[model samples]
Target chain A: MTNNTEGRSAFISGGSRGIGKAIAIGLAKSGSNIAINYTRDKEAAQETVAEIEALGKIAKAYQGNVADFEDCQRMVNSALNDLGEISILINNAGVASRGSLITDTNPEEIRKVIGIHVFGTHNLCHLLVPQMRAAERGDVIMISSVATESLSGRGAPYNMAKSAQEAIAFTLAKEEKVHDIRVNIVGPGLVETDMGKRLVKATRGVEDIRELDKGSPFQRVCQPEDIADAVVFFCSEDAAYVTGQRLYVNGGSF
Target chain B: MGELDGRKALVTGGSRGIGRAIVRRLASEGADVVINYHSNQKAAEEIASEVRKLGKKAEIIMADVSDQSEAERLATESITALGSIDILVNNAGIGATAVGRPHVATASPDDFYRLMAAHAFASHDLCRMIVPQMRESTRGDVVMISSIAAQSFGPTGGTYAAAKAAMEAVAYSLAKEERGNNIHVNIVAPGLIETDMAEMMVKFQGRVKDSINELAADSPFGRLGYPEDIAGSVAFLCSERASYITNQRITVAGS
Candidate 1:
């Protein structure tokens, strides 16, 4: 599109790889600076920063576990210091489920999944919305999953966390609209990513993730760039009037 | 070139307000257009001329969508004029409150049915008339121009809100039913926009309490929405960029 994102800054969690990295690149392509958060994977996070720098945009990486409230506060404050007044916030850090039914899933695994997806999303919004309001404009996005709608019996933890995340986004959309902040959810289905590969290997016993792409009407799995495009649209001037919406990037698949 | 390089579209209520803006935006994006208007032939023709100026084909048809048979006729005429209908925007409706002030207790039953026929029934009729044609295309889009009133549930806007809510529910169901055919059904719900419809609401509210200017001041953005604001969102949804997006409700209402 256009370089309308110039002078804007964004903070995205889990920006080391997969969908988050693609979003970082997409925003940078539109001329926005980035502050990326990663729980571990310092090497991958650094590589993301390098890629953004290669594209002539400023970027830096921070270490934090978004599930912990204190870590979120620290990362957000540091990101503001690094990138100056964050205009966009993406709560994307998450862990995939172990594909256990509700009764069979371990309590600790459930807690971890909920902690990362639900609490992590709230923590970032709680920390960043005030500054966004002070500035009088901002965009917040939650990376949810189409699993919420499919309600796969084996994905209870992931479904519970993602469904909860969407509810939070809807409520915040109403609450933040008065302040000129737009909140939205981008729910991708069966995207070809590291997590998608892992899920397929565990569930379908397949090594190649591309095999899961067959059933979509489009005859392909969703790519990280596909989801990234939706995020960029929601963060763009074109979406100024759009808020509290959940866009499903599922390639016409159920 | 634009996103809708070879697409053809039909927009109901294209004479004025948000519908007119959608017609303009789609034309600007390189889509040939057919617009349906109930009574404002002058305004409809004017928009058609503007669309032609954008180097696109444009036609204006006269049909009151609130009539089921008339809506079907309009759909038939739209396809005839445009050659194919790749995009259908359900934007026509009786002005939101021509039915009268909002209290359910005081609201007339006839007014409720009239509003329902104008908003929900008209959309349902048009969707049924056009989906078969849409299925023949490689990609098809249907956008329901709803209202935030459906979600807000304001006391005075019960009939209007109920009609919009029913339309949204229908849109969601249609999204599921039509996904296999590659037809995307979505909703665009605009908040308080600056239009003749909003002006009417202001005048009706004036008798009860506030002035028109106060209504403008109500948005968190410090102003009412321009027609282009809603049109921009609709244009995005109609583009290929939104192929992966379906069964969604986007509100063009600023916070």
Candidate 2:
């Protein structure tokens, strides 16, 4: 996080909904200009922009596939155009496949998971690190999943990719230490969102999920704002010297 | 605007250590401050002196917060002087002993109770007295100065840990009950702080400087915390930057 977010602009991927949107609104509330990316979901993206603007911060919407390297670069350029420097980057866009064994997983879903979670995060950092290097401060937030270390995921592709995401993140944290840029990952548990609702619907109910969540001392399903609050905290001066950290905002759920 | 411009702040135990650091942090952010001290009138006045140099109005008051009545009195006086408190930091706390003597059969129950009274009970009293003002204005911040002992289960820290643990519970209850008022309450727990208490702990605990330094270097931030480190969290709680944050504890562990 930059020491001051007043004149800074944050670029958030998949900010149209879920925790990403909550983070966008949060940063806007902190007086940071915003640039949000959505893949052809113009209405959703525009709605996000409106909310950000309502907080009295400038916001622009970008249409780009965050998973593709070239398109990720384009999104960065667009955000930079929208606001001269993209100071904070939220690599939140992701796709979670239904539980499928590694052997049974479709090749397409494998490609989708790897492309979005790994390459997408890599693409943005490779392009944006130079600017943060120049500015002497920046933040990169990777929205990882509990599947990375949890017993719940049957989707091997997602679990494997997210696990790899942390390795890449730690590597970047080591590399970016000199630039005073922080790279951290926020690993979340079951959150109530469109993706979560879909997972619940496909499961037919949220009882077991709720029961598993209550197993934690917190006794509640993780909310999108819970994850968003972590991102906000990570970007605040409270984390000025915090880097290379993997903070779990998973409501005490192991 | 500065994050704390024109905000009214009350800092307990502002005479020394982390409390003094918080006073400097808030004053720099444009808040008029009231510094409360249990003793060391000279130290409290010195901190207020620095606040005034920052062009913020500051005054020092003497009161032992370990006594519930004195804590309530301190709250009342600050409310009257500051017109209303926009920020309240419960940093006034006393250690059971400056030396981290391992708990033996000889541990002092009276001293333990004093530690609990100083940190936990006084904090509760201050919260109860200040909540009405915080609720009426619908804008206030309450920051409890907890410790790593609260979260880490420190050895021989029965009194310290219990006080901090109970303080966290009280903070959550206060935050939940007053959420409608928009008041934010958070805990700032510091680990391996570079303070006199830390020096005592490190020395008496037989912790070598090199080992402590290495541990500090192991944190994500790669260093032990200065008082300013924890003060930043306190300032954030009081700022426009943290309007929606409540019922949380932020550990300023170097990492």
Candidate 3:
């Protein structure tokens, strides 16, 4: 509830749009400077940077592929130079896998999904956590999906990737506690993001995401801000004693 | 203004230790609170006065929630005092030592049932009586203050673990059933907090001859968790900041 992130700096991957952007803005609003990471969409990333700057907080965008360890290193170095002592890392950048069975899916697709979600999370933590150790406190939030819980058929790559990402989160939670670095996971059920729209169109053939609202809890689908709110709470002082935890922002669906 | 301004909360066992900390935290967040205490009227009155000093409504109700009829009365009286319970914190329960932590083979059925009544059944009764009115409110939040014992299920703690686990089941089921009505239900499981209950456990065990502080030196945080640690999570769950969170258990165990 307090401004726990005040005077701190955060580096958020995939932070140009969707849930990542919301988290970036939320942390900025909570008084932290922002370093945004994006795989593509430089214009969208810049827009987010501008929004954070408007809030009187420092903001910058770094273009890099999180799955590439070298690229992650490059981004971390640049962000450290720009932001100085990045203490919060939001592993929000992710790619959804094609909803196909493991046998039917191409190996390349599986690797790409896993690389973005699992390996990408690892690369950031590997780079930023050491600097975080020297700071006052540190927070790592993995923007995982509810797929880890559902494990629905034909979504093996995504489910496996998210499950692995959470495994990293839980392990890091314990490993980093000695250093005052708290690790937690935020799992969101079907949100009205661009990715959600695409998935719905491909699977349910629903053009408008709101059409599924009647079947959704509270008669509405989850929003990027809804997921962001959970991340913000985890980053706040309210969760000072909370770690190695997973909060499902799914309207109690799963 | 506090985030919980205009909200009303009812916290069970709210006179001492973790429950008392929760009462203070919720009141500090601008919520009018109904403090439910089984005994120790002096402690309950002291907490109520503190809340009133914060410019919030504070009322103390006495009832042993483990009794089915007393739980009903607590629910009715809490609503009468606070108008509608926007936040309900089920925190009134005894430590493992109170029920006699014995091996499963030697554990008495009486102790098992007593533990169940004090935790699982008490929570069930309060939720059933309070949730219907919560439906008409803008938002409702229920937080179950369970312990890590429910998950760990360590030796000689079967009765307590079973009761807490059963309470968690109720929390999960209620979360799903009430999500449509904008109600959020979650659990905060604390591990070895520095409370009187924990001290009682330490004294009962007899193996740890050292004081609580010395014993806490080996904990994950190098110190035992404070009562405020558990209260912070409970207050966060009750606020709108956690509106999307439900059917989840956050273990505030440093690890």
Clashes of each: 3, 0, 0
Best by TM-score: 3
How close to the true structure is residue A68 of candidate 1, measured as C-alpha lDDT? 92
List, residue by residue over A205-224, the lDDT tens digit for candidate 1: 98998776566645567788
- The worst-scoring run of ten residues by lDDT in candidate 2 chain B lies at B96-105
Question: Across residues A1-254, which tens digit of lDDT does each residue of candidate 3 receive?
Answer: 56368999999999999999999999999989999999879999999999999999999999999999999999999999988998999999998888888789999998999999999999999999999999888999999988888899999889989999999999999898988888999999999989999999999999999999998877788899988888988988878878898888887855
Better of 2 and 3 by TM-score: 3
TM-score result, candidate 1? 0.90
| Candidates' C-alpha lDDT | 0.86, 0.78, 0.91
Give the per-residue lDDT digits (tens) of candidate 2, residues A1-254: 22346777888889998888998988887778998888867998899999888888999988888788889878788788779987799989888876876677889888888898888888888888889877646888888977776745467888878888888887988887766688888787677788886777676575445654544323456678777767877777767755666655553322
Clashing pairs in 2: none
Off by over 4 Å in 3: none
Which regions of candidate 1 fall more than 4 Å away from where they truly are?
A1-3, A68-74, A147-152, A167-171, A251-254, B102-110, B207-211
Off by over 4 Å in 2: A1-11, A15-37, A42-88, A94-138, A142-233, A236-238, A243-254, B95-99, B104-106, B208-222
* Per-prediction DockQ: 0.46, 0.17, 0.72
Candidate 2, position B91, lDDT:
91
The deviation in Å at residue A172 for candidate 2 is: 8.6
| Maximum-DockQ candidate | 3
